[model samples]
Target: MSRYESPRVNAGAAKVVLIVLIVLVVAGLVAASSVKIVDAGTRGVLLHWSAVDLTQPPLEEGLHFVTPFADDVINIEVRTLKYERSTTSASRDLQTVRTTVTVNYHPEKEMIHYLYKNLGLDYENRVIQPAIEETVKQVTANYNAEELITKRPLVKADIQDEITDRLNEFNLATEVISITDFEFSLLFSQAIESKVEAEQKAFKAENDLLRIQVEAQQQEAQAFGIANANIAEAEGEAKAIRIINQALAENPNYLEWFKTRAWDGKLPLVVGEGGTPFIQIPISP
Candidate 1:
């Protein structure tokens, strides 16, 4: 009976070993099935057996899981990126100009795969730089040196708009574009400056001439007013003189009346013997 019990105990030990091996295999499978990590400010796009799975939008930050051996993961940055280009070209007037530009951009998450496929990491070299150069050249060809210096903002806007339109057609998103700096030949700069100064001087001289003309007009108007007033006053005086002369010529008795009035007002109190006695009239007309 003891010997039979010993064999049964060994059989139970074998069963326990087999169960441990099975558990170990299951644990290994589980570990291999689930394992992934996502970095900060990044997202992971998962593909199962080379086919994309849209059920989950991109995996968020921190650790994540998938069918480890069967799934492929792509990590994409979700941060803004900056690109700068400094290029030189010839203007319409055959002048050399150097321009520096900076752009802020980022990939559209949904279109990252497309971007990766169509334009790789060198997309700026293949697309943006050429586009910038072409557009700038076109705009610069349309404007002269004076316009470039004076209308810088307008020119910048035109270039930005044109580039933005072209990039949008290619499905790339743009955040900001800035013209950083520019350089012109010393001779060209001096010439433009001189031209601008001459224009300003001409404008000032024209304004001075206009002011002088206005002052002259005002003086002439004042002089004409004074002459007209003097003429009117002289005509009035002449008319009064003519009326008095006409009255004197029409009535000769005016002189006798004048003399009689004058004689009564005068006094001499002396009389001669042959002369009639002088009498004073009292209240008789």
Candidate 2:
């Protein structure tokens, strides 16, 4: 080993090292581009620009190899995934309603290859989202604002059914759909409240009128009862007088007998028109 380091020697060593480094870098990139790892719950679609090799089957989860730039493997989800959308639409009564909807869905594993070839990577925005929006609007339009609140489950079912049918045509399967929340404009809610209040007040007024009518009828019935009782008493008194007259006609001495029966033990002294003693004492024979 010489302590005198040669510049030419150092240059040769540097060249050799640089070449090795370049080869290593090239090898790494080629290796990376050659193989791909598809995750579980996902399927892959292969594309070779403008060429469909019918023999190449769809790729399942695991490792795969392909030409670096000539081919591309796009992964499509095959497992259930949630998508949420919030949109505003009009009800049957033309009230604006805001709804948040969630859908759990997945592309068909065997059919996703066709989807990738046709729809490309923008399937969610181009197909699924638009389908959901259209179905939501269509279903919401069938129900009034109050019915939308009261029959929320029915509304959701109709929406989901429409969406599921539409997505099925595009080779997508729906697992579930949930409506997270529903909101209406502040003005509409206030209007509903005002209407309800007015109806309640009207109902109360009607009840009050019915109660007053019933009380009036009760008073009239009471007055009629009192009049009937007074008439009966007068009739009984007249009948009694008629009977006494008849008895007197039957026997003239009956009057004296009646007077004697009616007299009390005490007698009052009286003056007659002749100014003589009017007192008459009855003696028992």
Candidate 3:
């Protein structure tokens, strides 16, 4: 026999090589299944044997190692996320209203696993959004559409507060909320506009009435003043005429002096009855 066995040993060596290749492939597969990477702004929930591992904390962002083909990772976003929805409801006055809202929120880091277990990825849609709609309706029912427009800030605050309280059960915290849009029915809008216009017209009419009253009072005061002035002037003239008559009775020549002083440069067109004609006789002065 030769020192090396024929084909049997060679076959045995081939079997060993095949066994090593299979082991390496299995190891590669295990490693491939074990390693996982969680990107930024996300946390990974761990599931061991298809059941969640409650004791284990959520895997932070980056590479993680879990049991190959046994443990699974469910990525839960911990970053702030915006959820927008529209709601149509009736106001307190039964006016139809359409409202749009944007809610900014994030998972409670400590309760994320609990959130996932309870609500899952549809958390916002199932819980948060529904809660928002309900809250908006509850608050909106208390105010008319007109009050809603005037009290928008108050309404927004009420809705945000109520929704936050409701979503607390889902382990979600609301960061910010905005009521982006509000609309009333066409009839309501037109009625509001007409009401405003009527109020403006009524106000203008009131102002016009006040202005007229003030002007009438001022004109009355002015007329009274003019009448008093005329009365005083006539009384002064009568007093002067009485004084002149008394002086003439005391001294008859005073009338001639008065006539001489009262003469103007122009002659009368026609002398009055029994009055002196234009006879400028030269006086021996």
Candidate 1 regions off by >4 Å? 1-43, 47-64, 69-72, 78-81, 120-126, 150-154, 250-285
Residue 125 in model 2: shift from native, Å?
1.4
* Shift in Å, residue 175, candidate 1: 4.0
Candidate 2's TM-score: 0.57
- Ranking of all candidate structures by their lDDT, best first: 3, 2, 1
lDDT, model 2, position 65: 94
Lowest lDDT sum, 10 consecutive residues, model 3, at 276-285
Give the C-alpha miss distance for residue 226 in model 1, angstroms: 0.9
Which pairs of residues have clashing backbones in candidate 1?
A: none
Error of 2 at 40 (Å): 2.8
Candidate 3 Cα outliers beyond 4 Å, as residue runs: 1-6, 206-285
- Candidate number achieving the greatest lDDT relative to the actual structure: 3
Clashes of each: 0, 0, 0
Error of 2 at 33 (Å): 3.6
The whole-model lDDT of each prediction reads 0.77, 0.85, 0.89
Model 1 is weakest, by summed lDDT over 10 consecutive residues, at 275-284
As for lDDT, the candidate ahead, 2 or 3, is 3
What TM-score against the true fold does each predicted structure earn? 0.65, 0.57, 0.72
> lDDT score of model 2?
0.85
> Compared with the true structure, what per-residue lDDT tens digits does model 1 show for residues 1-285?
998999999999999999999999988887766777777776677768866666656777687778867886667675777878887877667788888878787666665555544665577788888888888888887777666767899988988898888777655677898888878899988887898899999999999999999999999999999999999999999998897678779987655555466566544476446663343323436
